[model samples]
Structures are given as structure tokens and as C-alpha cells.
Target: MTSRRPLSFWIKWLLLIALVLGIALGVTRALGKRKATSEAARATAESLQKTPTYTLSSTDVVTVQSIELTQTVALSGSVDALQTAAIKARTAGEIQGLSKREGDPVKAGEVVARIDSTEAQARVRQTARQAESAQAQVAIAKRTFDNNQALVRQGFISSTALDTATANLSSAEATHQAALAALDIARKSLADTTLRSPLTGQISARLVQNGERVAIDTRVFDVVDLTGFELEAAIAPADAVAVKVGQTARLTVEGLSEPVQATVARINPSVQAASRSVLVYLRVPALPGMRQGLFAQGHIVIGGVTALAVPVSAVRNDKPQPYVQVVREGAVVHVPLQPGATGLKGTEPMRAVEGLPAGTQLLRAQAGLIREGTAVRLSAPATVSN
Candidate 1:
């Protein structure tokens, strides 16, 4: 603390210089560390930019080809009867016995049942008696007319009496003829007691049992023609237009392995008043064990037509319209396409795209992440498969 001012000037200057040098050294080290770090970061960035593109493995790219497809129109309905007939008695009589029962098969004119006709027989006998009385009157009048003619010729009878006898004889003859015709008609009607079938079919019902009092024109039985069953169903106007007579179809039944084959038979042009649907009739191809009124599902083929198709996966819906992932220079690009028809039901590749050209190669695997241009590897070597 004593008299230091003059002596401290030189020392102060040297200390100041040392402090400046130390500060400069620290600054220089920091700058060097920062520069090294900056260079390292730049090199890493450049390396990353030069890396290979992200792509799928060769086993991941699945490819399927486009094929010809056809559009299908479908409608549904159930089975029915082709013809139904109710057998009725033509003459009134007691139902004596039945020759055929329900479910029994019979041909046209075959006896189904019989009836007691005791009253019909009695009516025939009464008609015959009337005919015999009229014939006796005609004979008596004819003999008297002949004797009157002989007496007139011998001058013993009047012309007016002969004429009266002749008129009576003619009237009696006409009455006798009318009575005989009535008797014949009554006997013929009595023969109708043997009830017969009007068609070759199975008996569906029996309205009269044996000993039942049946009246004329009474329904005796119900029969259904089962040779070929009719399937009746209603379809929309749009669907009916596609259906024409004789178009082949397939019938699907629950729990049935094989579908029944059939053809379109009739189409009722008049729309239903309530449902506004056209009635359609389909005839199943005859097969044994087929029964009328059996519930069944019907499908009409209409017909098949060929059109371009593609793998459904190839079709991308990401955009407002449909498109596909097209590869370009190891990047992604989207290509737009129009979709068209489909193939047979199961035959249509599930999730398969339709309407592409037949030769078009499409992506069939995971469609996501597939860009327009990306490295692509086929599950099977595409070059070899082609």
C-alpha cells in the first residue's frame, strides 16, 4: 500500500497483456469446436440424400391379369302349379264308393269314384212306361184309320172320321218318339254315376266320401298336373325386360348342393295393380322328385357377355373418380380408368377390379403405399410368368 503507483505501471501493463492472450485462446478453441460440428452435420445430410429408394421386397408384389367379364341381372321367385283342376260331379247321386284316393295317380277318363243311382234308374223306367203307352195309342189309331178307309171305300164310313183318326195316330206316334228319346237321355245320365278323371295328374283332394249325398255339378276332387312345375314370381320392370321366353336359368335352394336348371316360360305384360311388378313364370327342367308348390329360389342368367376386367385391388378409389398406382422413376403416380362388367359370381375374383383391358397387368397385393413410381418386385417373377 506504500508508494506503489510509479512501480505498478509496467507490471499492470504485462498483466493486461497476459489476460488478453488467455481470452483470445479460449475464443479460438470454441470457434474450432463449432466449425468441426458444422462440417460433420453437412456430410451426414449429403449421405442421407444419396440413399437408395424405399421399395417392396420381390416376394411382396402380387400381380393378376385382367379378363373378360359380363354383367349379371338377378331376380327371385317361388315354385307353383302348371295347371289345377277340380273334379265335380255332373249328375246328382249318392257317393257309393271311391276307386282312387288323394295322392293317387290317374289318367284322363280313369274312374275316380262311383255313385248310387237308384233314383236315376227309376226315372228311366218311368220314361219307358210312358213310351209304351204312347206306342199302344198310335197302334190303335192306325188300325182304326185303315178300317175307316176300307169302310169309306165300301160306302159305310165318313171322310171326316177317317181324317180325325189319321191325325190322332200321327200325334200318338210323335209322343211315343219323344218319350223314347227322354228315356235314352235318362239312362245315359244315370251312367255318369261312375266318376272319372278329366286329366292325367295326381289327386290333390277328395271332396266327397263314400255314402255322401252329392249334388249335380258338385266338386268331387282336386287334381294338379305335376309333369312340369311352374315357378311364379314377380320382378321389376327393369328386370323383366332382360328376361325373355326360353332363357336358361339356375335355381338355388337352401341346403341344396346342386342348383336346379330351368327356363323362362311366360311373362305377364300387364303390371300388377297393387305391387306394380310383372308376373313371371319359369318352368323347371323335369327332374324326378320335384314337387309343385315347393319353395325355391330362382336366378336367370339372361345371357353372358365378355368385357375387359382387372384385379379389384388395382382399382384405387382414393380420388373422386377411380384410379390406380402407376410406377414412374422409383416414385408414385396415379392413373385413372373406367370400370365396367363383372364375371360369374364366385368366378368374379373377390375384390377384383373389372373393365380393364384383357392384357393389363394389375397389382393384386397390399394396394396401400403403392405409389405411381416405386421400386416393385413381383411375388412371382413377372418376366418369367409372362
Candidate 2:
């Protein structure tokens, strides 16, 4: 630079200074843009922190309280008639006079159907005639034996001849006894042609037509008593230990509006091999419009307890630990919970929980999910138990 430079050289130097100045200006503009972006981001975060995330009403909050809870075990099964009978054919023949159909009322000892009695009647007549003939033979044998006895006493006949007469009389008497037995059997067969209802109930099924021939022991009709009902349920082996006879339950049956009451009637001592469950039978009082095979579900009241609890719907499992959304200083806070037994508080399902003090307010399930530290505004503060 000390030496006088050429014009071209000076022009190159000038171009270099211009390029450096442009670079510096571009970097300064870029830094200002970055600082502006950071300030805008910080402002947005502050605004979100100040505004309420959710507005909760009094109904959306539940309060922890000490309550009397009825502990219950869930159960489900089908409603069945207490007494059921399968009317079967006692003798094989063509079915006749089967006027009873499904839903028809039946009385105990009522004739539900009849089998064709032609063969049975004929057998009875033949056996009766044979019985009469045997009776005459028996009378004749007695007379001969009596005569032999008199002759022997008077010495009108030899002792060997009397012995032979005695043998013949014994044989005739045995024959008459056998004939009478056959006649009684024939009469029973004739009586068996008529089928009668074994219980007072309604017919649930009809297996044969009037003209159909059925074999002995073939099922013909199914009868069920609707005056009393029972629910047959299977309980897990672990839970069966607490279930005892006389325990009460409330069941919601299919197609019925009102909940039906039931009492545990019986529990099987053995566990089922297939499902490893114990069978439990609950007796239900007969109600209008109740039917067999109606599906039912309910809970059995095992015991009761007084403890700090909340509604079951308030507990959430979305986090790594089970927690309930609690309101603290106008902000949503997730409090870890140690859930205990589940029960009912005046028909409202409640769950025993720890890690929260009594009278603490918590969000219900209907509030959905709110992030931790989110601001919450309560329109009206109230204590909702369930």
C-alpha cells in the first residue's frame, strides 16, 4: 500500500472491503432475527402459564371423605328355574294326545301326553286271562292236596302216592304265583302309556309331535317352575373363599328395569376342572315377567368398612403409577395413589385410596386428562363424593 498501487489492484482492494462489510451486516441481521424469535417464544410460554387450561364445575370434582363402604364381589350368570323337570317317555309307543306345547301351563300329576295303548292293553288282557287260568289251577291243586291229606289220614291212599300229589300241588302253586307276577307287570305297562307332569310348571320345550314314535326314556317335554328362581354363577377360586351362603346380592337381569334381590343359596365345595371356578347358586324371589335363562350380572355384598375413599371413576392409571388428579392452589396436580378395596357408598361405587388427606378435592373421570401444573378455574366450589 506504501507503493502507489495500480488501478486494477486498488479496484480489487475496494471489492474486498465491500464484501467484508456485506458479511458483517448479514450476520447482525441474522442475530436480531434469532433474538426476536426467542422473545416471542418466551412470551407465548408466559401467556400459557397465566391462562386457565380447563374450567371445572362443581359436578366435575369429587372429594375424599370417610364413608361407610359395602365391599362387594362381582358375579354374573343366567337366571334358572329353581325346579326343572324333563318329562320322558316311560314306555315306547306312538305319541298321542300331546296337547301341551311350549309356554303352556301344567299342573302336577296332570296328563301331558299319552302313548298308543293298543299293544299294552292287549298284553294286559292276555295276562289277565292267563292269571285266571292259573288261579283255577291253584284251586284245583289245593283241593287235590286236601283230598290227599284226608286219604292219608284214613289210609285210603299209599304214602308214596300222597307224596307225589304234594309235589304236583307245590308245582301248580309256583306256576300261579309266576302268572300273577306277569299280570301285574302287564298292568304297569298299560299305566305307563300315560305321561304325566311331574311338577307344577310351564312347558319350556316340546320334543316330539303327537304322531311321532318315541323310545322309552326319550325326552318329550321340559317343564320349569317359575314361582322361584336362582342364579347359577361361577366364581374364581381365590374369591370363592369369601363367598358364603346367606350373603345377599342385587342383580340387574336382562330385559328387566328393576334390580332383583338375591341370596346365596349354595356353593359347590369342589372347583370345576375345566375353568377352575366354584359354582355358586343364589336364590331369587319370583317376580312378574322373570324367565329362565335370562342373563344377569351383579355384585355380592361380602362385608363393610369405614375408610377414606373416593369414587372409582376418579382414579387414573395412565401414568407409571396409579394417580388421581387433585386440585392444589388453582392448578391440576397428579397425586400418586395406593388404591385399596372397592365398594359401594349408598349405591355409588367407591374405592379406598391412600396418599391423600380427607376433604381433598380431585377431578372426576369426566374431566378427561389435564396436564400436570395446568391452571384450573372452578365455577362453583363444592364437594362431590361420587
By lDDT, who's the top model here? 2
Clashing pairs in 2: none
lDDT of 2 by residue, 200-244 (tens): 999999999989999999999999999999999998988888999
Give the Cα error of residue 1 in candidate 1, in Å. Answer: 25
Output the lDDT of residue 374, model 2: 88
TM-score of 2: 0.90
Number of backbone-clashing residue pairs for each candidate, in the order shown? 13, 0
lDDT of 1 by residue, 1-386 (tens): 68656767989999999999999999999999999999999999998677556555443333334333434445566565677788888788788768677899989888888778787889899999998998998899889888988988898878988898889888989998999999998888887877888889999888878888888889999988888677787888888888889887778754456788888889997999999999888887546666666677756766555444444545677789887664444455666776555445333332334443334444544647564555544344431011
Q: Which stretches in model 2 have alpha-carbon errors above 4 Å?
A: 1-38, 41-52
Model 2, total clashes: 0
lDDT for model 1, please: 0.71
Tell me the deviation in Å of residue 338 in model 2: 2.4
